[model samples]
Target: MSQKNNKKRPKSRSWRGLFRRRSDPHRAYREKYLETLQYQHRTFDVKGLTTQGIFTLELARVFVDLGLGQMGQRPSTDPIPRFAPAQQRERHSIWEYLTSESLQNHNLAVLGAPGSGKTTLLKHLTLTLASPESLPESVQGMPRMPILLLLRDYAAIIEEEPDFSLLTAVKQELARREENIPLDWLAQDLQNGRCLIMLDGLDEVAKPQLRRQVVAWVERQMQLYRNNRFIITSRPFGYRNNPLNGVLVLEVRPFTPEQVRQFIHNWYLANEIKSAGHDDKGVRLDARQGAEDLLVRLRQTPVLLDMSVNPLLLTMIATVHRYRSSLPGRRVELYEEICEVFLGKRHEARGILYDLTPAQKKRVLQPLAYAMMLHKQREISIEEAMAIIDEPLSRVSPHTPRNEFLRMIENTSGLLVEREVGMLGFAHLTFQEYLTAVHVLDQRLEHELVQHI
Candidate 1:
C-alpha cells in the first residue's frame, strides 16, 4: 500500500510537471485583446482589407526591432558648395582685394548691371571665404567657423518674423552645421575670430522694408564682428540710402577690353576643341575658324566684351553687322531696334516719353528732352540730369518707382545701364548714338510735317 501510494504521488508530481502552470485563459484573452487593439491602432481599412494597417504593423515591428524612431529627419535641399578661392579667381576680383594689404580697411561695394557677372563674383567670393585654406592666419585665434548665410535663405527659414535678427539667424545657421562640427568649438579654436559671415544679393531681396531691416542688421553684424569682413554686391540706386556710407566703397568696373577678348578667345577655343573631338571633323574646324574671326570682331567694342556671348545676341549682331558692314552702325541699329521692340513700333519717331501715362508723360517729357539734349552733347549722370531738369526725383514720374523705371530702361533693349547711383548711361557710345538718332528722327518728322503743311 505504501509503494502504491509513493507511485501515485510520483505520478501526480510528474503530471503537475507536465501541466506546468494553468494556461490562464483570461490572461491569454487579455493579451490577444491588447494585440487586437494594437493592430487596430496601427491598421487602416483599405476596401474591407487593412493593407495599410498591415503595412503599419510591419513597419512598426521593423522600427521597434531596429530601435530607430527617435532620430528626426528633415527634407533635403542642395548642399552649399564648399569655398575654393583659387578656382574662383577667374570670376571675382574680391579674392584679390581681400588678400591684398591695401584693401584691408576698405569695405567693398560691387556694383554691376544685371547679368554683368555680379552674382557669379559674389558666389565665388562666398565659396573662397568658406574654404579651409583661405582662412586667414588671424582667424585661427577665433572661436567659431565663419558662416555664409544667403540672406534670402535665412529669410525663408525665419518667415514668421518680419524683423529678423542677423545674429540670431547666424547662430541658428551655425547650429544647423553642429552635426558636421561644433561651430562653438570651431570658434573656440579660432578664439572667436573664426567666422566671416557673407550676406549675398542685397538687391534681389524684393521688399524695401525688409531691405532696410537687412541693411540695418548687416550694419549691426559689421559692428559685432569687427575682426570679420563683410562683402556686398548690388545694382546702384538700391543703395541710395548708402547703408555703408562711411565704409570704403570699391566699384566693380566693367571687364576691360583685354579681359573680354581673352574670355571670347578662350570660349571659342574650348568650343573648337570640343567640336573637333566629335565625329564631324570638317564641321568642327570650320566652326573653330568662324568663332575666331567673330571673337576678333567682338573685341572691338568695350560693351560687347563685357556682355555674355550667347547665341541669340551673337546671331543678332551677325545679322545687323552683315547688313550694315560697319560695326558702329550695326551697334546703333541694334540699340534702336531694341528700344523700338520694348517701347513699341512708334518709339523711333514718337519717343518712349509718349508711352508714359498722362501725368507721367508730362513729368518725363521735359527731363527726357533735357537728358536727350545732354546725351546729344555728351555723356551725363542722372544726378546731372536731375539738376538739368531742375526738379526733385520724386516729382519726376512719381507713379513709376525708381527701380521699376530703371528696369524699364534696362529691359528696353539693354543699351542703358544704371551706371552708378543717380546715373543712367548708355552701355556704349554706339548706344548713345542710337538714343540721339531717336531724337533726330523725332525732330526730322516734325520738320517734314511743318514743311508739308
Candidate 2:
C-alpha cells in the first residue's frame, strides 16, 4: 500500500510539472515583443543601449499591462482611415526637411497661428523620436530618451532659482513616477551622444525678457552639448525672428480645407478604434458616418478642424465662445476683455484712466507695449526693450520706490515672468496681445479725448 501511494504521488507531481511548463500565450507574446526590441538594438552602433534598458524595465511593464503587445491589441485596419493629398505632402515635406542636413544646423522652430495643431505636431515629433520602431538605425545607437519640457514650467523654475544646478532641476522633472525616467542614466546617455530635447510652447512663456534669456540659455547649452537637438513651437506673434534669428524655422501652415476634412476623418477613425474593442462591421459603418459629419464641420478653418473634436485649445475656445458668440467676432474683443481682467479694472474705468493720465499711462504702458510687440512680431531682449522704452534702470524699481512702472504691470496680471529677480517680460503671446490691446486702446482714447478738449 505504501509503494502504491508513493507511485501515485510521483504521477501527480509529474502532472503538476507538465502543467506548469505549458506556455502562457500572453507571456510568450511579451517575450517575443521584448526579443524583437532587443534584436533591433544589435543593428545600432550604440556604445551601450541604456535608453532601451531603462525603458524596457520601466515603460515596458506599463505597456504590457495595457495590452499593447497582445495579438489583437492593435486595430485590424489602419487607425487613420483617410488622408488628403495635401496632408500627405505636408507630412512628407516635414519628414524630409527634418531628415535633411539642415536639421543638424537648425533647432526646429514650428510657428503657426493659434489652434493650428502646433502643440500636437510637437507631441507627435517627440513620440516619433522616442519610438524604437520609428527611429533610424543610427538614432537607435544613441542612448538617451527624448525630453519634452514645457517652457512655462522651465521659466517658472528659473525664476525661483536658489543656486540649484540645471541638472538637478532636470532630474526632479524627469523622475516623476508616471514618466519613471532614469535621469542619471539619461544624463550619461546624453554624454554618450544619445539625447534630444523638445522644448514646447516658447510662445507660452509669459515674459519676453525671460523668453530671450531662455533662448540664450538654450543656445549656450547647445554649444555645450553638441550632439543633442532641440525642437521649439510657438505662435507667430511672439516667436518670429527674435532670439532664434539664425535658427532653422518651419512655419506650420494652416491645414487646407481638404486637409482639415482628412484630419477629421482620421481623428474619428482613431476614436472609434479606441472606443470599440474590435472593428466589427457595425463599428466600421458608425466610424464612416461620424467621419463624414466631422469632415463637413472641420472644413471651414484650421481652428474648426480642432473644434470638430475635443483638444485643449478647443475646450478653452468652446468655453470662451459660449460666453461670447463666435471666435473671429470676439478675437480682438476677447483680448481686450482679458487685458481688463488682467489689469483688474473695468473697460470703462481703464478708458477713463487713459484720458486722465496720458503721460503717466504712456510711461507705464509704452514699455510694456514695446516689450509685447517686440516679443510678438520679433523676439527681442529685455535690454533691447528697455532701450526702446529708454527708462532709467534705476527708476524701474527694486524697493518701495515710486517710479517703478513695469512692476505695476507685473503685479496686476501675474503674467510678468522674471528669468532672474530683476529681469521680466509678459508670460505668453496672449498676454502680450492683451497688453498690446490695452496700450493701443488707451493711446487711441487719449488722442481722441485730447482732440475733443
Candidate 3:
C-alpha cells in the first residue's frame, strides 16, 4: 500500500517541475510561441500565374534577396495635406527604424496609399523580430515579442460588442489559430514592455464609427501601456485625425527602380522554387532570365511600367505577364490577354455539371460591363445586374442558373466584386472599359458609340 501510494508522480506534475515552471512560466512558452510565430508569418502566399498554372508562392523565402526598404518620416513641421515631402523628410531603413531607439522611444503611425505594401512592411517587421533565422545588417538590439493584430478584427468584435476589452481582443487574436498561448504570459510580457504590438489597416475598419472606436481604443491602450512599443498602419486617407500621442509618422515611398528590379527577380525565383521545383542553379538562372525578360516586356508597355512603383500592381503585372507570355507586343493584345486570364479562372474546369463555358460567361460580362459604362455607373444593384446579365446569359446558355452565374463571377473568377452589400461592380475600371470595347467591337455596336457620346 505504501509503495503504491509513493509511486512517482508524472514528471510534468512533480513538485520540482511545478516550482521550475513557476520560476519562469512565461519564458518557456514565450520562446516557443516566438518560434511558432516565425513559422506562421515567414511564408506569404502570392496568387497568380506560374509556370505550373495558377499558384501561390512563399514570397518571403526570397524577401532578404530584395533587401529592406526605407521609410520617409513625416516631420510635424510639414503642413497638413502636404504630400510629396515639401522638405526632405528624414529617411531610415525600415530595419533601423524598428530596432533603434525610435520604436522604444515613440509610437509610430505609417501611412501609404492602398497597395503600397503597407501590410507587407508591418509583416516584415513581425517576421524579422519574431525569432528570425538572421537579422538584416542594418538592424540591431534585442528581439521583442511581436503581436500582430488586424484592427479590422478588433473593430468587428467591438462592432458586435462595443464593450469588449482590448486585452481580450489581443488575446483572442493571438489564440485565433488555436495557438493555445497563455493569456497570463501575454499580459506579463506586455506589462514588462517586451511586446511589439502592430495594429494593421485602420482603413479596413471601413465604417467611420467603428474606425473611431478603434482609434479611441488604440489611444487608450497606448496611454495605459506606455512601455510597450506600438505601430499602426493605414492608407493616407484613413488616418486624418493624427490622434495618437507622441507618434512618429512615416510614409512608405514607392519602390525605386532598383527595388522594382530586385523584387521581381527574387519573386520569380521564389515562384520557380515553389511551383516548378527546379534545381537551385537552374531555378536561379530561369528566374533571372524570366525577370529580365518581363522587365523588358513591361518597359515596352508604358501603361504597365507607370504602375510598377506600386507593389500590388507590380505583383499583378508579373502574374498576368507570366500567364500571357505569348501575348503579341500590341496594346490591344495586352488587354485581350488580361481578359483571357480573368475568363480562364477556376470556372474553366470546376468539373461541376453546371459549369458554364468561359467564352459564354465572358460574353455575359462583356455586355454587362458595356452597360455600366453606358450608365457611367461604378456599380450596379444585384437586381439590375441580373436583369442585364440574364438575357445575355440565357442567349448563350438557355438553362443558365442566375444566382449561380453571379456567384461564379463574384467568388470564382473575381471579375465582379460586391462593392456594397447588394451592389456589384467590375473588379476594376479597366476591366469595364476593355470589356465594353470588346462588346462593342464583337457585337457590331460601334454605331451606338456616337449616339451615347
| lDDT tens digits, residue span 1-453, model 1 | 001111110001121221233563333332332233233223211121111111211112111000001001211010111223432243434545454444444445554433344444443333333333444563332222334456655544344564566555645654554422222333332233434455666654445676676676667667655555566665444454445753544444334334434444434444444445543667556655655566666766655543433222332344344334456434655654434433333232222223353333223333454355454533456555545434433665555554555444543324445535456655445445455445546555445324533
TM-score of each: 0.47, 0.47, 0.65
- In angstroms, the error of model 2 at 328 is 16
Index of the highest-lDDT prediction: 3
Report lDDT (Cα) of residue 422, candidate 3.
84
Worst 10 residues of 2 by lDDT: 62-71
Please provide the root mean square deviation of candidate 2 (C-alpha atoms, Å): 18.8
Worst 10 residues of 3 by lDDT: 1-10
Give the C-alpha miss distance for residue 138 in model 2, angstroms: 10
The candidate, 1 or 3, that scores higher on TM-score is 3
Off by over 4 Å in 1: 1-93, 101-107, 113-116, 127-191, 205-209, 270-291, 299-398, 401-429, 432-453
Count of backbone clashes, every candidate in sequence: 16, 9, 0
lDDT preference between candidates 1 and 3, better one: 3
Over 4 Å off, model 3 = 1-24, 47-54, 62-91, 100-103, 136-138, 160-163, 241-243, 276-279, 326-445, 448-453
Report the CA-based lDDT of candidate 1 relative to the real structure.
Answer: 0.42
TM-score of 2: 0.47
Candidate models: Cα lDDT each: 0.42, 0.43, 0.63
Off by over 4 Å in 2: 1-93, 134-144, 160-166, 178-182, 274-277, 297-453
In candidate 3 the C-alpha lDDT for residue 253 amounts to 63
lDDT of 2 by residue, 323-427 (tens): 344554446554443344334342123231222122343345445554456444434445655555544233443242323344444432334444344455554
